[model samples]
Target: MIINCGPLTGFTQARYVIHMSTGKRLVLFRLPSIDPTSSKPNEKEGWSYYAMEAECPHAGGPMADSLIDIEDSAYVASCPWHAYDFNVETGESSVGIKACTYPIDVRGDNVMLEFPAEDGLNVALSKIEPVSEKVKLKNARPSETPTAKQEDSGMARYLDDDATLCDWAVHILNTAHPEHKIELTTHLFAIFTEREASSSPMEIGRGTVTAPDQPPREKMLTVNPGAMPRTGRGGTLKSRIAMLHALANIELWAIDLAIDICVRFATFQTEKSSEQLPRAYFHDWLKVASDEAKHFSLLRTRLEEMGSHFGALPVHHSLWLSAQETAYDLRARISIIALVHEARGLDVNPMTIQKFRLSGDAESVEALEVIHHDEITHVTTGHRWLTWICNQEGTDPVQVFRSNVQKHFRGPLRGPFNEEARLEAGMDKRYYEEMPNVVAAS
Candidate 1:
């Protein structure tokens, strides 16, 4: 049986997945231009194509987001989840495993894949429905720039000049679906980055926005902290999955927290201060929101691979509760959410990574490593902004951070801390070393 994947023009270095009715999946990839002296196959000497199973053999990692590169005269795709490389043509891996490959033929402008004929084979292409065409915002200021056309996911909602960064923040905050929230968060960040790189003016209308008290979450089970299940040391598969689900939930809330601080306090001006926050402040938090979205995506994918998923287990409302306590003060928000909660992550992530390592779950380890690296920069961003705000107020940032934690945070800081990572993020030991050392509630 043959299936027409799509036009060759639609293909790039990015991997695309093709689903078959036989419950099998194939990923299509376009090879880059290869050198003439390379030992590639004749049909694959120049720009070519190949199809392989969409799931990585290692941990069922999604290959559609794999990183493609040329190595040893061969095109290789590295699985995004664990960085396992596979030869595009042969599906051969250096780790003694092989992904199933299929035959492909390009006819004119179309790319086709061949599969074994079966008694009840179906090759109908899955239809992609479009997202809502436009999101109307009340009191939106008209701009000269026309709204960009909505594509596969209707990501064009905020591309026009009239939609302020605060507008986008509120939109994301109000989204209830997890996948849609992730998509919107990512697209908002991409649009912001593109505009910045081109030196285009991005409207950030402060004092005209009001973020939701709490972001909308769909059907997620929440329980008190004491009611949460024990995920013991990640020594068992169930325990590891529970740990990942908990982390995923945290990252989801973190995405909201990052974006929330942007618009929720967009109008904030300390006493004796007249200026609102600079654009760079919004940029930093948008990047943080984007990173949190990515971390949540990784953890969710890992959970599915392990036969469980987010929302499968009850989560604690402690994270969002903290967000609420600090909602009235930007300094308190930054102090508790970033400096305290995120800094606590910096302390605990290494041990979490080690737990996955001990269990031989390399895929989970790789995902956690990426989160750990990005979180260091997140803590750094929090510190940088906190200091900037304190400088404006003519107060010591350390004093302010300590004050906010003592006021808004529920319990004392605990340690067996990762001091090195904390220092690297500009969080000095003085920030927490002298804080009350009472044992934290479970």
Candidate 2:
């Protein structure tokens, strides 16, 4: 039996699972040739196609989702569950197990997989089906599907067909109560990470969900940046509380920003785009949102400890204003928010910590230090994705970043920068050192 998977170009995902009518499963891989220009005499020039069983021989891990990489000039797919490496061409594994391999032929641009006539199969690619209904191909090991009892627990809310990752993101953005938003954020992050580690992973639905123009909020007064009350130096208790409240407000907006990007620009992950993002993109932003929630919780707790709270002070709408400006462009959003605003946090964090230290507020100092360390990673995540997008477009990252910032940002770039943290986050001097309108520190 011969099955035509599709055109070679349609395999945007490196690996695709094909379900057979006989209940067997096979994974097709379109690997990169070590030497695209050279091949053995009478063989194809680009020799990089393979087909193998979908189950890992050791434990029934999802081989289709294996991590693909090059080892010793050969393609290798490491099982997600056990890290067992298998050669794509020969199916030879490090643990002395040999997986079944099949013949794959390319006629023109169409990829064809052949099987014995005895094993009849249907003609359907799993990629076109809903993720929840995909066939489960496992070895003789016990199935990892959740039991009825487990499905009835708290995590069941996220396991439903309609409650996709994007759906949860929209739900979080619409939630107005600060504590409830934090609770939902924590639950969604936990569920996603837990399912990803299990045999059954969470589904990231189509990127068609539209984020709200502005996140829901209540009670907390919003004012222009110039009109917001000043948070004086952290020497006195009143000033310290004010500073914490301000920081908490930023963290709250940050949570929305992170989740909003996941849903708002999700279509970029599809094959329709030239630079397709993998599922890892959603994972990264959800992780960022989770960290922001933690930061907000810490600041809120600290405020209550000093007889204050987050909503006690008014905050400027400037942060969300930036979000609105870059709502349609992912590049601009990353450039202005992560590289500009969040990077600024790294610059001022040391001074903020020092102030808390001098005022004998060690707890506040500790909290700021924790936030400072995590902010560096958050900035790094943004830089990494921005660079990936630029590489796909075959453009210089520095030029793209500068262009985006100049197009979306209104004010001059300020100095007295934290050169060390920015460097650690992969922002080189070329990206910001010699801006056209840089304002030196006074």
Candidate 3:
């Protein structure tokens, strides 16, 4: 609970300011009430300090300048911007939502706040975009003439029209730059927050949208499955990072595949409309897409921590090939992509977790564990939707899935299969049990 913020600065000497490990700024106001048992450096036995989020929630107004001492009252820090007030103890905002507050403590003469033992989320920059320093240096270059300086134009919205919301998601898919991650995250956030990217249907242009190339440096050095260099694992750090990058690459493509499915199949006929299947269908893909984004970011961060990056090594384009094969059909897409391919991911993740554990890379292990559980849920969504489609068409779900696999998926279905995870994900045994026999009989 209480983490050492290191000897409460600005106390007993200057105006108090403190920064949390999570990059949140806080200011210490009133001192703590007396605690007789406390033996801290500047032992003000019963003293504690009140701290509030450094900036006002309303408009980034300064909370320090407008500080209010309530004389042992509930409400502590007050913001002058909109006259908002908050309780330093609880972070409760007088207007509506709670303010950000921290529990302050002094130990061994060191000031500490209630922070966790583990490092918080890797809010560390992933470097998908250039650093601001580079931009500043470029702007500082000397100009030959004192002509009117041209300011950079503002970015244009991808789809421009809210009605063609699906088209905007497709635009994100087609963006091949590394910065696409930023745009994709922003777009997904907007959708969940009900700002832009609506589920409303609009008649798209005649041609179908093709999936974009993976971000540029990432699209580098592609190799066939057999050509993939054996990634080192076990005790060596290099191999561990290399292996994590390979997995991250798969997740990156999975994001694209999920996006492709949503845009590609938005036109499937249903009882609802001709423009696309109901929002339910696309929403399912969006959920998968969202998880894939998180998985990729987690794995990518882990990779960077180990001194390698996602595109620093070669990757097989194997996942996208399945996308191309199923580009035209919803049945084949879910059957082959989610059930067959991703289910294999489920089967192997436990062993992968063990590999990272053996290497003593707990961070990588944790990321893989998250992706592993999510894959089970992702496959469950695919199976549910696949079943829904089968019912809509009045066909047997298992048989149709089998037929689609045979027609679309190449070669033998390989697996020591993660039967438990498959079952957990709602995949029936009869489906896989009959699949090999059905394929063999065919």
Candidate 4:
């Protein structure tokens, strides 16, 4: 592969081929790479210069800098800013919530990159030399599918014990860390090709709660069916608390994916057009991740006091479903996960807190309060990123959001929205203002 590196102040229009370890081949520019600051002018393709896959559109994190393409839809890229997992083909961002599919051209065994001329320097079209293919064509496999077995196995491990060790293993299974960066793509694919049965609801230990004749309010203080463990309330209070803690932990997994996507854009390492965002754009994502981490810890501690722990209850896979459906699109992912889910959190968390409060459970309410405060910021981050993207793309945020949501989700949205929280999150008044009419009509 060859790349015609446009003439820059320091580099020539040199072409270079990159033989990726995954057996895929591509071209790299030999001329001075992009400075990631200069604004791009409308130029012809041959005169256009661009950064390789090192930059993410969501968080601006360095992608190509430390990444390995594991398969077609899956690749392990280390976020230079924060360690995260990124799905290359599907753009399924994990950890920091950011990544984008870049444009490239392939011509037989040769690939080419047309870069823009820098400093207003005009140069003739440069012919790039193609490198010879040493290996037989029949032996090379094009990335076509994701490794299902590896994913399932990793998920199984996570389900079984989700301990700190499991966390590190998951990180390795999902990334190209120093020792685990092995190209097990084919192996993983082979193992997970067939669909595996979904997990069954867990059977938690139950204990009779003998309380003095309870008051009328205590009747309403019963556990929420929606949030309760698969095991009935006959379970010890400690066991029930463990179930809530596990629910919180499950929420963290989803947050991790969202966070990586956001970080990818903030630390993006490419030439920024006048319209493109900067590194500062991603600071809010870090704050969101921190909040999620805190929420997880608080819930865990509360569960411990109840004499149980996270992973003691069965959890749903709906969050992972959203992540998978929007894997190829960042706009959809952010809107659904952050705007839809986290925004709803502002309402849901408070309601849950109220439930605990009425039940005289101070510990749960305290944890919910922390979540509520931080969640305000998280929703705001979504609004900021979503609104900015709308401006950049010259689209209506509300319309785009509605269309994407309809395409991706099937559940009904419970509202009587937390208007105050939405306001803090940077949601435009027009959206919330008109929401009632839209919902009523629907």
Candidate 5:
């Protein structure tokens, strides 16, 4: 069973420990310690006698609203109030880390923590907590910008396409370089205007841009032209080999954007006050980047079996387009890519799997399942960051999300929107419940 402590409540032996199953993880605590207790007691309140695990590593403030950094197996917690970091394992100040850390110990299947005892200023403290030193981290720098080297990754290539009509759709979908994204997009416009297919680089599409802001003028592109692989390859291994190649190519592209969005933009720039994103965010994003590459490789292999290759069918480029449009705005970027598009993947993936299964292609289905599961986590990340951005701006995240969706996307958000997936992805309850109400055009 899982026991979640109050957001502001710190480690109290009774309030903190939970008996988790093997391989299970719990949300041990929300905020680290807002009501820090240091040798204080209150019999009337029935509890007392505890101190903060560590000072706000950011600037010796209280650690509040934080989560343990399970990714590194390090004893650290992320401060929710200001994103100040700390090291719980050593009780040392992870102040420069710019995120909060909390102390925790797991004994066998049980997790234990020492709750800080609260002082008598309960009512007075509640009002002051938000504005207190605990809530503010000092001298944090802005988030790290992507370095020049990173600008040359596979994903970066995809982002460099020009913004033309037919080619626009292609650029959106193509796993080209980032710097080339604008040029690719520009080519799209020229291609559409030319009508006649040019000897242009592998761009496949209708030569037109429909909605100035929407997507491919023609929504129905399928797997055919890009099919028919080169002969003289291997046997069953050929497909697998091809898949690996495509996966590697696409993955490099996918992870680059994931890292930029999750770490640099969301975690560092938007979520943390001191402007330093949690190091854990970097690790997490890299892992995701690797996983996405694996998924793409796996799927590419499956496609090869059907005499098709990665570029056979025209894949919509909206996914990256959304990422591109919101490049400057992490919140908007996550909202579109992670939340909206990834969420859509939750729904669409099952159908893809079903199609593969019906075709007796179990291998393809398995690859898709891997993507489906991982996509959920990706969506969850988006949800967390989006919520954080909303909180930072002090606006109703859901409302802001709605307006952004209207402003950004073209086709209405279809329902069959994987409601179950959305909940698991950390979409707010109200948003999930009211999803049907957010009608996309028919």
Candidate 6:
């Protein structure tokens, strides 16, 4: 049961605390202190509302009484009971106890929270503006550069492949307007071809630019995995719109995720003979980002033809969850996202295409066909890189692949896979032949 607390009071006020109580549960304590750096581009200070459990795990002490580290950039909190420190931004406790942070979001001025619906836990907030209207992208491109203080307006900053692409991705993800993302992404890809992939020593300095990985969306509608609505092949028009929207969102996330692989990992490559990664790594992912942008465009166009817009329904950030989960190891990312997630797409696309075909939605079928074709490349790119990374570590590719599946991939690998497509994508049977107890591709 998610609950709305109220409008955050301290935007200009500097600091304010929101204590939500329903008799001893005293469950929520949200304090928003202005982050002075919020004015910087892509930095959304208010959105970083990190709220942890009310009581400290160490001694059941109320966390509301925790000390704030104003001097420190991470803005951590220290429990006074035993001096256990925690990064409030991440809820990471130095003492190793789960902080049990509740998920919350600030949309417009309204602050919302989600917790167990039990014990009559509910609070409403000030009125939220209706979700923003969609704006179509104008295809006109200026023939000459604008020297009027804006030559590099976001997408035009094609300075370096890794850095520019990363900047564009972050900008797209951070744009608060909730505009036509697919169209914006298509325009961004032109910038990719405009620049060369940088081999400038895996720039630890972002090659030139960088931005936080927060993906774009209106105030998020996040919920537990169990909370997602039950969706299937045959459903109402609303359900079909939802299903298509979910797919479109995955492609949207893939755009950032591919760029993330580029800018985040390229720094590891140096002149040292030990660095196994090469320029081709960035190239492969850039291509992946391009393909993803196309996939998004197709799906979004189809959605409009269906009389639905991109943000007409809710979407979860689960695909990006794979990205966040694998932020530490490139191998884990490939194993889970490509081998497990994209591979599942091979299994599911044909059935989806068949569904659209049955409904006489030729437009959807054609768009999905393009997606199906490109996903082969997407999966292949993941396979190629994971295998290379394995070889660099001097670990057996097959064995390491299995290890990653067990370690990072959450569920059993479902199949009835497109065996032909998987093979074309360079995913050999050994990676999934008997691993994780997958069912055979039907």
What is the descending lDDT order? 1, 2, 3, 6, 4, 5
TM-score of each: 0.65, 0.64, 0.60, 0.45, 0.45, 0.59
Model 6 over residues 308-367: C-alpha lDDT tens digits?
A: 887766678788877777777777777788878888898899998888788777877877
Candidate 4 worst ten-residue window by lDDT: 210-219
Candidate 3 lDDT over residue span 1-442, tens digit each: 5555444443552124555545766666644443447664433545656566778777665565333434243435655334467776777775787777766665656665664435654322111111010011112213332122324222223444333435655676765543344345345533542321223534443235544544233356787989888876556887787788788778877877887776677667633323346555655566677667777777767766777776788888788878877777888889999888888898889988999898788887877877886777678778877877776777787887788877877666666788878876667676676455334222
Per model, state how many residue pairs clash.
Answer: 0, 1, 10, 43, 61, 2
Q: Could you give candidate 4's per-residue lDDT for residues 181-222 as a string of tens digits?
A: 122212222222111111322121111111111111111123
What C-alpha lDDT, on a 0 to 100 scale, does residue 159 get in candidate 6? 30
Where is model 3 more than 4 Å wrong at Cα?
1-163, 182-186, 192-219, 270-276, 437-442
Error of 6 at 217 (Å): 2.1
How many clashing residue pairs are found in candidate 6?
Answer: 2
Candidate 1 overall Cα lDDT vs. reference?
0.77
Which whole-number lDDT from 0 to 100 does residue 251 have in model 5?
43
- Per-model root-mean-square deviation over C-alphas: 14.0, 17.1, 14.9, 20.2, 17.8, 25.9
Query: Model 3 clash pairs?
Result: 5-112, 7-111, 31-48, 32-47, 32-48, 32-49, 33-46, 34-46, 35-46, 41-109
**What is the number of residue pairs that collide in model 5?**
61
Tell me how far the alpha carbon of residue 145 in candidate 2 is from the true structure, in angstroms, after superposition. 19
Per-model C-alpha lDDT, please?
0.77, 0.75, 0.62, 0.46, 0.44, 0.61
Tell me the tens digit of each residue's lDDT in model 5 across 119-196: 642211111112111101122222243223445333233223343223334334343432233223323333332332
